[model samples]
Target: MSDENKSKTFLGFDFSTQRLKAVVIDENYEVCHEADVEFDVDLPEFRTSGGVVRGEKGEVTAPTLLWVKALDMVMDRLIVAGVDFSTIEALSGAAQQHGSVWWAKGSKERLKNLSSEDFLHTQLASTFMADSPVWMDSSTSADCRAIEEAVGGPEELAKVTGSRAYERFTGAQIRKMHRTRPRSYSATERISLVSSFACSLFLGEYAPIDLADGSGMNLLDIHSMQWCEEALKACGDEKLSKKLGVPVPSATVVGNISSYFVKRYGFKPDCKVVAFTGDNCSALAGLRLRSGWVGLSLGTSDTLLLGLQEARAPPAGHILVGPTSEAPYMALLCFANGSLTRQSHRDRLVGASWEAFNELLQATVRGNMGYMGIYYDTAEIVPRAVSGRWLYDASGRALDKCAPQFEARALLEGQAIARRVHAEDMGFKLDSSSRVIATGGASVNKELLQIFADVFHTPVYVQDKHANAALLGAAIRAAEVWSVHTNTKLTGSEPSISPVATPYPDSEAIYTPMLERYRQYVDTIPKLQ
Candidate 1:
């Protein structure tokens, strides 16, 4: 570390569903400060539950100005915590993937001409034409179906845009807006993903979507790293292309800090702003994953991220462009029913105790004595299954119920196996050198992690600061971009990680046959429905 660089710091912000978090790291890439603003708690005026408003017909959205206000509040909180904003050389951020923000006609001028005398949210209160449909929204199923059909079919759409048309994707959401809210859609001048919208706040101009995050929307052609015209027509019209602008590489330096931030918050005028990306892509950067390594985030939903040398248009899951050059393509598999499903079963069958749940899991033998089950408390994304629970005996005959220990083990094993299956289908190769970097709320559960290790036939590792991966990733990206633009070197440090679980010797032998049986059971799901 150079003495000249010792005083420099970088900032990373995360605009998540429930809260907005900020992480500051010095030139050494070590965290020095942190702050956050919870939407439901800090911004009560929005009347949001879990940071969003749920309407009829499975619609979920968040007030666009709510995020504007959060940025205002989070910066103030950072200042209150004694962070020296002037010493911050660069900043970047990550946001929940797939949420689209509509900038009303003439809003670009409003963003660029902001004054330091007033708060950002107050000035931009009417900038958006409508609330932003978030990732949790399922109201776009019909739109998704129409898009897939227009583009030939599910497989062809996947080949073009990296995944089959999904309800939460921004393209479908945009299509819904154009159909149901034509006035708002016509009044809109520019459309930004949550990631780019946050970046635009810093740039004081409309920011182009980064390749990594742009891939999440069904509008981008991952193969060409450009917008797909056919896909765009499927969503709306040719004019939609201009509203999206051109996409940029994730690490591109978008611009300098806005004058509003410079005068109001004491930020350096020359501080750079890197293009922001999806939270999952930022987490991938934060973990510093390498070849043969996969990242598992076990939270409200479970997502598996695999870095790919080349893109694969899997029938299930999603493929995104990597944030950094080391990995050019990435595969993502999301399971909608994660911790909540486990908690439900635990509450109903094990006295609502995780310790008891663990005890039950430990008491049961491998493969749950050939008793397998699939549980979805809500609609599942991977297999597209509806809410239901199906259990089977060794011979694959359906059963109404099973032993509590067996039930507990079944849920854990089922989730692990499903992750492995979908990941492999997306071209994830497991071998002796392969390892899983686990993070998120449920990653702390050693018993659950063990099941993942056994099912994937690989060891599992966790970092000391796993929960803040998205925030850290944004900071890392900021530092990387700043270092390149300034021709300065960074004092890099390895993350503090340790292996939490290793596969048993007979793990592969035990779970190999279960994979086929699990698939067979999954095939019978729609029939049973």
Candidate 2:
């Protein structure tokens, strides 16, 4: 692309659990340059194992300064890659869903005056709650139950908020903080989800949480797209609504790039900043999924996402507001054990080598000779939520032993089966014409994807650069929002979505019994209250 075309460039950012990635694309949606800053590797001073600080009580958090530091580092790296920031016409971002960032009183003033001479973290180190609670935190079970009971029951809460009170959602987290740290809760002037916090950094002001991301908070009424009074009261703060500003549409332009970026990185002073949304919503946009297509994301938490024309809140899973500013919704099923559980198996049985793990997995037959198991590093979120490793026989009876090969195959098959069962429960049907698109870190594993195909009994599709879909999705959102800003039609044709994994002809014949066994035997598995 030439300098003239550079004026049409759009930049997108993804503040994921393990990394902060940036993707720059031209109006044609062709990649111009990309860069990333890994938390563990690049910001080692924070001492986070998985980009979060974990506690014995199921607490999980990250230093807010670490995220700020990553932004500075990533932008520097992008500049080094020859990205001309001034030419970037618009910017948007995606963040790990459900994480909350607490901004200290007067932080907006601090942000507005950021010095061009210093890095972002150095200036804004004390402007936020020292630690930001993340989606991995499960310490708020008590609060979850309280909120559910307060709203009559779990079913009622689901009807109102599109999901039952989940431990990972922001409402429970806020309630816990309100009870334990009253001073901090009172001192907090504004609370931003991870998405809006990143947006605020660029906008130099507090950004309203986008509706799509806010739906995950358990406070928004899905039907009205506003905070539910009962839900807010249950969170222990009658005034919390003011702190969590009104949500804007995902495509709304929040503001221009902050003057700090204009001076430090050469961004155009008038460059637009679109509302940032949850990473999952961004993934839906990146995939450009059509009706009859479902997406299985293999990230920190494995998610099965299906687009719906009308909203319906199911007892299990979630119905999130769509990425678009219109009526469509996205049905989502999230599993706590995704790449981490798979990595644990790989380390124990295959010396942490994907190649060796793939070899062992392929060596095993369909049912693993009657050995089946549920492998969870932590509690899961499908069917009935539970934790721990469970082994069973072909008749669905408990077993004391299983071969490592069986365990390996069971891990892959178990996840596939869980997603399939939950998707069906949410009214997703897999037929002859249905297609599955796989993304995230594990999508590159053809061996694992074959399991997905066989279990879902459908062909799995992938884009050319599927792994970075979240970042790419953010970029696309930025471009789309910019088009709305300028009232101009976007220039590029949509990218081709193609199949990368297909099931064998006998897939259903082989896995039909296994699926039935899973449905019958899962009831026998232990669960956490």
Candidate 3:
């Protein structure tokens, strides 16, 4: 709480609705304490004409209550760790991007009651328990299509917001919320991005939305770095303040930790609350991927991001927007496709134990481009509006037909081609001449890494996913705030391993014809409209 203790330590939350990762790092940036709090994301389903759905189909949404539980668990873990709640300097967070949480008009005052035993018992508990639509669930594609028609299409949307109206984007979700839940939308005080909501609540102020999360919103004007007045007015809200709107630097000192949080954490009264950011941007920071360093994330989804010195609107279908951090900008191309696709096919054939699949995969010699004949879809269902059309074989079987292993190889080949196309479309080349670093779960897989290296014809550096980089990035933001506010010589989160890489010992074959076909397929898909 005093000037002497300001440099002690810091804390952060990687706030996901499903699971919360709490991290404690001292002034040296080493992990002193950390815990992952898991909770159910009980999003009730809405009835659809076909089935229960998420956005338009009577699909259910994640409630704000789950978020509250995640918070409670995170807080409880931090407390149990015997962390000097006061020495925690300040906190910020990384959360699911574009998900919205509503609050009553004056909920700002309500957050200061951190010590109240009635915390979960309040109405706030119930709200978070339901309807927190994550940044997936493409049930709202219809809504996106409608909006695209009204707003002149995806290119128009991109020109203004640096993104298209994808079903998973926050903009489509917002429009869906307004039409289906007018009362809730009207009663909503500030439609908080999950990142902003957490930072605002803990800091005891109306926290500003940082560039990363704000960039996910189709409503935010990427060129100007503010909410688009025309879009907001057209969306039927003239008063912009009610919605979380503002683009602050990633490390901006939004405010100090509220007395309630300080007392609860036992942090000094002067602990500063840093600006919050999104998981994607936080991951970039955690990776320590600076300029000229391209980051490839192969998690449940795949994200290829390049940090830049200034903001640039994504050309046509490319995604160019604010870095999830305080950097000037970052260009990202994310595909909903990833290991999930591989798992689905494996689930069907290999059953619950993936060890068998791994063994089979390991024993299977890499034939000269075993997947060269297959054509996988990028993002699976975008452009063509199709899903799971496995159309390929490995052992020189059928012409237009398929084999069992077809799906598995297709998923990989498709995503590889998708990555290659995305690079070229975004004005970046995928040749061996360019620099690239791969992160995420898939990066650890030797085969996947080799495939990517051969496809891009570039060496792929594997990053250590040891600690959740996003959580560490959140700590970086928190540490920065603590330093500037209290003159604390706090440490920032950084990667332990260097990103330099070496090639696999296997033959790095190139399938020129397959690469050509994949590029053609991606180019033929209709633009968003």
The local distance difference test score of model 2 is 0.87
Best by lDDT: 1
Model 1 agreement with the true structure over 308-391: per-residue lDDT tens digits = 778878888999999988889888888878876888899999777899889998898988899998998767888887668999
Candidate 1: where are CA atoms >4 Å away? 1-6, 343-365, 393-405, 527-529
Ranking by lDDT: 1, 2, 3
- C-alpha RMSD (angstroms) for model 2: 1.6
Candidate 2 local lDDT, residue 203: 96
Clash list (residue pairs), candidate 1: none
lDDT of 3: 0.63
User: Candidate 1: how many backbone clashes?
Assistant: 0
Across 64-139, the per-residue lDDT of candidate 2 in tens digits comes to 8899999999999999999988888899999999999999999989989999989999999889864889988888
Q: Is candidate 2 or candidate 3 better by TM-score?
A: 2
Per-residue accuracy of model 3 over 1-529 as CA lDDT, tens digit each: 5666454677888875346788888777777888875553322222221111245542435556555655666677777877767566667788866676677665655665545443432535533312566665565677676666666777787777777776666667777767777887777777777888778767766688886678787777777777776556545556754576567767677777776665555566767778787777777777777555667777655677777766555653334454444456777776655655666666775785566655555544443345533232233433333343434344434345444454445556566766776666677754445556776556667666666765666677755445366777788667766677667454444555544444444434444456566665555445432
Please report, as a residue range, the 10-residue window in candidate 2 with the lowest summed lDDT: 378-387
User: How many residue pairs clash per model?
Assistant: 0, 0, 26
Could you estimate the TM-score for every candidate?
0.92, 0.97, 0.84
